[model samples]
Target: MFAIFKIFFGLGWVSFGGPAAHIGYFRNTFVEKLGWLRDEEYAQIVALSQFLPGPGSSQVGFAVGYQRAGLGGGIMAFLGFTLPSVILMLLLAVLSSQLTESSYFQNVVHGLKLLAVLVVADAAWGMYRNFCKSPLTVTLCIGTAIALLLFQSVASQVLVLVIAAAVGVRYLAHGNVTKDKPASATRSFSWLPLASFFVLLLTLPLVGTYSSSVQLFSDFYQAGSLVFGGGHVVLPLLQNIVGDQLTQDAFLTGYAAAQAVPGPMFTFATYIGYELMPSAPLLGAIIATLGVFVPGFLLLVGVLKNWQQLAAIPAVSGALVGVNAAVVGLLLSALYQPVFTSAVITPLDLCWVLLGALLMKQFKLPIVWMVICFAAAGFMAPSVANLI
Candidate 1:
């Protein structure tokens, strides 16, 4: 258990470049170095995470920890992997009053936002290739993107997913998509976790009426519950939640900070909570962080127990394909509206984005170094512009 915690804790400090990158790191450290899981076992875990609606990489980590040392180990793994980013986000929230007004700070933030743009673009393209290969799936992807681009509401997003699922069930269920093998250990089903998951999902909003803290928790929990793709996909959902509470500049700044840090992007909740409840920043940060994560973990425990059976069903498998394509579309829509619009302000900004994406793809530069270099460039760009 201690060894598990120590390894994940070290990873928390350097695991940048989002979910796909995190998966690669896990495969290298756990599978290649430690020989903890076979290649097929690791692949199954990732497939499980992809089918679920939450932070995929974090789910992968938790599942690995659970494999290592039961539920306590899973909880410890989460704490270890998320500690660095959560702390940094909380600190940024506290300092936003000063940071919001600094031009140099704005420059640094601009660069990080560009980084987000590049990251999301990469994610969308990869998902499109993997999940949207067939013509029917491709149509669902494009249609969902167009729908969300027009409506830009959570309701519309949910509707697209539902429609896509229905379409998949009607069309793709009998196709050749592979299903992960079920664990013998999980053959016996348990209902308590699934029951609790729904109870919380339904009851939290009503419970929140009596307490502001509960309301905050409920909102984040709902966001986490509904998110499909993973950490980066949480952006638009969260932006809506905090839009009334924070200035656009401050929210974007926090987002930039999230990208600069080295853990799950969900830790951005720490920044939101601290900013929202300055009188009790630590408490707020804890509540927000836990709120966003609890639903995902609960769902993970509930769904994985029955995943094998469900995946075996043709209709369900087809629906999942559709859902996956729709998720890519949702990310694509988000990339255009808020992420692209907010980040790219000048021709030079576009150049920076293209350059960053190229470096990330070709050179495979460490994300932390890329962030630092781009930030420095942003900080000096205005002076350079004047000289030119």
Candidate 2:
């Protein structure tokens, strides 16, 4: 248990660029570095998680633990993997105001922002290439993106997602999917712990912690539950919340801070936490941090209980292809809002993006190296400022 927590928490500390990037980290650490799983095993699990509804990385973590140990290891692994993110987000959430004001800090923020764009793009493309089984699947992806942009309501967007799923399932049922061997399904063995966690969360309101502190907690908790895709997946939902209530500067600052951090951008929970619920800043931060990841842990356990049935679903896999294609669109949208909005201050900054994207696509340069080098360029360039 301790080992699971330590490794995953360590992953939380080092994960940068967002969910897609974190997936890379998971593959490297668990499959390549530790030899915990074969490459095929890791790929199969990723295919499964991307097929499901919850956060992909957390699901992967649970799958790993479940593969190794029973329910106990799975639970420990889930919690451990998420702990570093929870702690970092809470701390940063408490200190968001200070970080936003510093101009020198913006360089690192912009650098991280660029990498996020590339990572999301790469992930979406890979998924689309591998899983987009038909033109209808392609249409579903395009349609989802258009619907999300056209209608701003969360309820409406969810309906579109469901529609996409239905379309995918129909496509799969009609098409062919044959496998030689069946995957193992996980059974429920830890309902007690699951129920206990739920009870604690459910009764928080009755416990009388419902101050501004609790409000922040509630907001991020709701955010965790509602968000789909991965970390980038959470952004549109966040925009709906932050863009309306907070100052543009506050929003931008918090966003910038999120990029510099090593863990998931879900830690943006911290930034919004401090701004939305200022009283008991640290406590607000803590709530926000934990709240964002709560869904990941819960869903990991929930999904593992029915593991094989999920991975075996052809429609689910098809829908994942569509969703991943949609993810590409989401990241493209992100390029303008968070990446370009802040980073393209100077004409010279444009060079950094072009170079960074080229490096990733053409030469296949490492993202971390791109972040470090480009950040230096942003600082050293004398004329760098908002291009517009």
Candidate 3:
């Protein structure tokens, strides 16, 4: 258990580049270097994460630890992997008020916001290429995006996902079925975690009315339960939940900071939680962080023992295909509304974004360097404007 915590704690500090990159990091560390699991076992964990909601790469890491050392190891893995980002986000929340007064600091925040734009665009486009290959799937992606852009509500998001799943089961089910393999011995899984997940999900909102902290937890928990694709897709849901409580700039700044950090982007909740409850910021951060992460881990624990058999079901596979495509669409909508609109106010901003894209795509520069370049550009923007 200590080893699991130590390994994941080390990873939390250096696992940059969001979910896809984290997957690579886990593959290298657990599969190649440590020999903790076979490549196929690692692949199955990754696949399971993709099909379920919450932080994708974090779930993969947790499942790996669970496979290694049981439930206690999973908890250790989650704590070790999430601790660094939680600390960083809390510090940023505490410091942001003092820093906002400085012109240079404001520019730096603006620059990081632009970085958010670049990061989300890359995620949306990459997922599009991977998930929207079929004509039917492409239509679903475009339709979902258009629907969300028009309606822009949590209900609309859920409705679209449901419809996509139904469509996938009807049409995309063809060719997805596989022949049955020889039955392996079934591993027993406790149902308590799964039951607890639903109990909290349903009961939290009712209890949340009496306490601010409970409300905060309820909001994050709902977002974690529903987010299908990965961390980027959490943006719109969170925005809908808390956008009114905080300024748009503050919200985007927290998101940009998450991009700059080196762990699960879901730690963006820590920043929001801290900002939301100024008097008891640490308590807020803890509650919000747990609320957002707990559901996914619970669901993973409940289903992991049976995952091989469950994943083999054709309808399940087909539905996931649709859900994945719809997720890309949801991200596309988020990219346009809050990410692109909030970041690119002038033609110069657009130019900066284009340049960042070039560096990311053509030169393949690291994310840390991109953060530095954008910060510098933001600092100099005022001088450049004067010259122009």
Worst 10 residues of 1 by lDDT: 176-185
Clashing pairs in 3: none
Please write out the lDDT profile of model 1 over residues 39-77, one tens digit for every residue: 545655665676667788899899888778877888888
Put down candidate 2 lDDT per residue, 1-388, tens digits, no spaces. 7787777776766566555566666765676568898754565566456545456667777788877776677777767766666665555555656755666666555665555555555555554454455677667656665665666454654566556556656654433455521343334334654574466456654643556556556556666766665666676667775666778777766676666777666667766766676556666666777777776566556655555455455665555444544544443443445445545665566676777779877997654476676667656555554432
- TM agreement with the true structure for every prediction: 0.69, 0.66, 0.67
Give the C-alpha lDDT of model 1: 0.77
| Candidate with the larger TM-score of 1 and 2 | 1
Ranking by lDDT: 3, 1, 2
Between candidates 1 and 3, which one is better according to TM-score? 1
Which one is best on TM-score? 1
What is the model-wide C-alpha lDDT for candidate 3?
0.80
